[model samples]
Target: MEITHHNKTLSLNSPVVMGILNVTPDSFSDGGQFQQQAHALEHAMQMLADGATILDVGGESTRPGAVDVTQQDEIDRVVPIIKAIRERSDCWISIDTSKAAVMRAAVEAGANIINDVRALREPGALEAAATLQVPVCIMHMQGQPRTMQSAPDYENITQEVAQFLSQRIDACIDAGIVRQNIILDPGYGFGKTLSHNYQLLAQLEAFHEFGLPILAGMSRKSMIYKMLDKTPQDILGGSIACATLAAAKGAQIIRVHDVKETADALKVVAMAVRENHELGE
Candidate 1:
């Protein structure tokens, strides 16, 4: 399937890698690496060269218990980088934010997508997205990052997430966002316990019942590292494993840190799936 945004459509019939660029000081991983514009641009170029189809930029760290940064701080960190990237590359740039002001500024700075873990539920978020008319990714997080992991719960993880996403879609529609410009993410690590995270991944395809493109972001999170008794710095292998599973389950976009490995793994999966299709002919 293809995800069309800002008059551009990304054909994700095969799995695609979306490299993560965090321009903050406290993201779960790769935090300080991109705070400087020069360094951030260089790393972004490297991700593109390594075969990233999209680059997701986040100014705020959404890791549980992370303190909130002011709107101006968030804008200052992302806009310049977005402007710089847009001038140099044609790759799809998604702003990872929950704030409406950030969405408006990032789009003005040339972002093509809004990847909000809050799913645009924040005040003015829907209005801002509608006004900008860019593609939006509505992700399911159980609660605010500060307290999301406090006491997560679910009767049926898959149905609950799918239902949550469905409601968000309707909310966006109510705010005047177009169907083709929307995508859904089940929020793999935002507020989920280990079991909850794995449950969501195992039943990922159920989200397709909503008929929207699914983006999976399981890159080096606690879900994998903690389960393996490893640290985030040592989760590349886990990341690839998760990426492969997500691809096999019909995830259109994989948000990740190690772009080359993720890209190569996805290539193998995509080739196999494509070959199977051709043989069926």
Candidate 2:
């Protein structure tokens, strides 16, 4: 499958890597590392070179307990970087935000996808994405970011998530957002306990019933670090493992910090899938 935006098209026949580019100072991992315009551009180019098919640029920090920035601040942080990357390359660019204004500005500055963690539940978000006409990734989060992790209780993790996404998908279609332009993300670490996160991953294929592409973003997240008793910086292996599993389960995109490693792991996944098909034949 392919998603088209303006003059860019992203193929989803196999799993693709989406390099994380957080331009905020307080993100859980690699925060403040690419806050500068030049550094962010450099990292964007490097990620593209490292086999990333898309660059997910974020201005606000969505980590649990993270403070929200003003809309203008978010636009300022992300637009220039998007423009710079667009000027240098025509690779797919995804703007990670839920604000309607930021979404408009990012698309104007050359973003191809709207990767909203709020699932377009924010005021005006659905309308903006509908008007922008780019691919939208709606994630399932139990609560708001500041308090999502406080008490993330759920009856059945996967079922609840799928239900929420189903409602959102209906809402998006109602708002005139085409079904083909939608993506699903089961919001790992957003409001999930460690076990809750794993439950979602294990049953991820259940979401395929929706027939939309799935975007798995468990890179350096607390789900991996906390389970392994390691820091975010030390969870590369865990991150890649999760990416591999997600790809094997038919995830279309893997959002991650370590682009090269994730890309390499996806290569193995592709090989194994081919071998399995051959054996079946």
Candidate 3:
């Protein structure tokens, strides 16, 4: 499968890593360090060197219970990094934002995708994406970040997520965005409890029912640490384990933090899966 954006098409036969670049002071993990242009740009370069096909740049912290940020602040945080990255390298950039204003500004600054957890439900979000003409990764979250985890429950994990994504895709189509410029993310930890998160991952291939690319944002998420009874800082093994599962189950993109490690592990999985198909008896 491929995601077409900004006149460019990216192949997703093997799972690809999207390095996380948070330019906020409270991104749940690795914040404050990349808040400055020099620091952020340097970090982005390192991730690209580590083999990330896409760099997701986010300004505000979407950590559970995190505070909301103004549109201008998000614009201020992401545009310069997008501009600076465009100046140095040609890595595709995805603006991890929910606000319409930031979506417009970041794309103007050379971003190729809008990774919105709200799934473009915000006012003017669909319109902004329509006008910008870039791929939009719509992630499904049952509730807002601050309150999503309080009592998260789903009657059927796979079906519920598929339904939500189907609605979002229909909404995007109605709003004038082309089908080629669309991707779907199950939003692993956004509003899901531990069981729900795993269930979705176990059944992630079912989302191929939508016929769009599936993005697994399972890099050091709470779902991993919670299962291991550890913190996000100490869950690399779990993260790799889940990333491997996501890739085997047909995920096209794995949004992650441990870039080099994830890239290496996925390289092996891609080769093994290809070999399995080739030896068809």
Candidate 4:
């Protein structure tokens, strides 16, 4: 399958790596590191060279207990970086924002995908995404980012998540967002407990019943760090392991911070799948 937007296309024949480029001052990982426009562009180029097929640029931090930024501030933070990256390379660029204004600005600046953790539930989000006409990744978050992790209770994690995503899919279609342009993300750390996160990962393939591409973004998240009793910077191995597991389970997009390492891990997964297919035949 392929996602096309404004003369750009990304093939989902195999799992692809999406490098995280957070230009915010306070993301969970790599925040202040890329706040400068030049630095952000440099990191974007490096990720592309590291085998990332997409660069997900986020101007605001959605980390637990994170404060929200004004829509204009978000646009100011990301537009120049997006424009600079577009001027440099044509790799798939995903604007990771939940506001309608940011979505419009980023796409106007040059973003091919709208990766909203709110799943387009934010007031003008649905309308903006429908008008943008680019691929939209609707993630399932139980609550707002500030308090999502406080008390994430779920009787049946997979079922509930599936139900939420199903409803969101219907909502997107109703909003004039084409079905083929919709993508699914289970929102690994957005609002899930540690157990809930793993359960979702183990049963991620269940989401495929919707017939849309899945974007797994467990990279350097609490799901890995908290489980390993390590910090984000110390969980590269764990992150890659999770990415491999997600890809093996049929996730088409693996969003990650360490693009090179995740890319290398995906290569091994690809090889194993090829070998298995050949032997079975």
The estimated TM-scores of all candidates read 0.98, 0.98, 0.98, 0.98
Q: Native-vs-model 4 lDDT? A: 0.94
- Residue ranges of candidate 1 with Cα displaced over 4 Å: none
Model 2 TM-score, all chains together: 0.98
Task: Give the lowest summed-lDDT range of ten residues in model 1.
Answer: 1-10
Q: Which lDDT value does model 4 have at 210?
A: 93
Give the whole-model CA lDDT for all candidates, comma-separated.
Answer: 0.92, 0.95, 0.91, 0.94
Which residue pairs show backbone clashes in model 2?
none
Candidate achieving higher lDDT, 3 or 4: 4
**TM-score, candidate number 3:** 0.98
Candidates sorted by lDDT, best first = 2, 4, 1, 3
For candidate 4, the per-residue lDDT at 18 reads 95
Q: Which ten residues in a row have the lowest lDDT in candidate 4?
A: 1-10
Worst 10 residues of 2 by lDDT: 1-10
Better of 3 and 4 by TM-score: 4
Residue-level lDDT of model 2, residues 1-281, one tens digit each, is 77888776778988999999999999998989999898999999999999999999999999998998999999999999999999999899999999999999999999999999999989999999999999999999988999999999999889999999999999999999889889999999999999999999999899999999999999999999998999999999999999999999999999999999899999999889889998999
Per-residue lDDT tens digits for candidate 4, residues 8-46, read: 778897899999999999998787999998889999999
Task: Please list the Cα RMSD from the true structure of every candidate, rounded to 1 decimal place.
Answer: 0.9, 0.9, 1.0, 0.9
Candidate 3: clashing residue pairs, number: 0
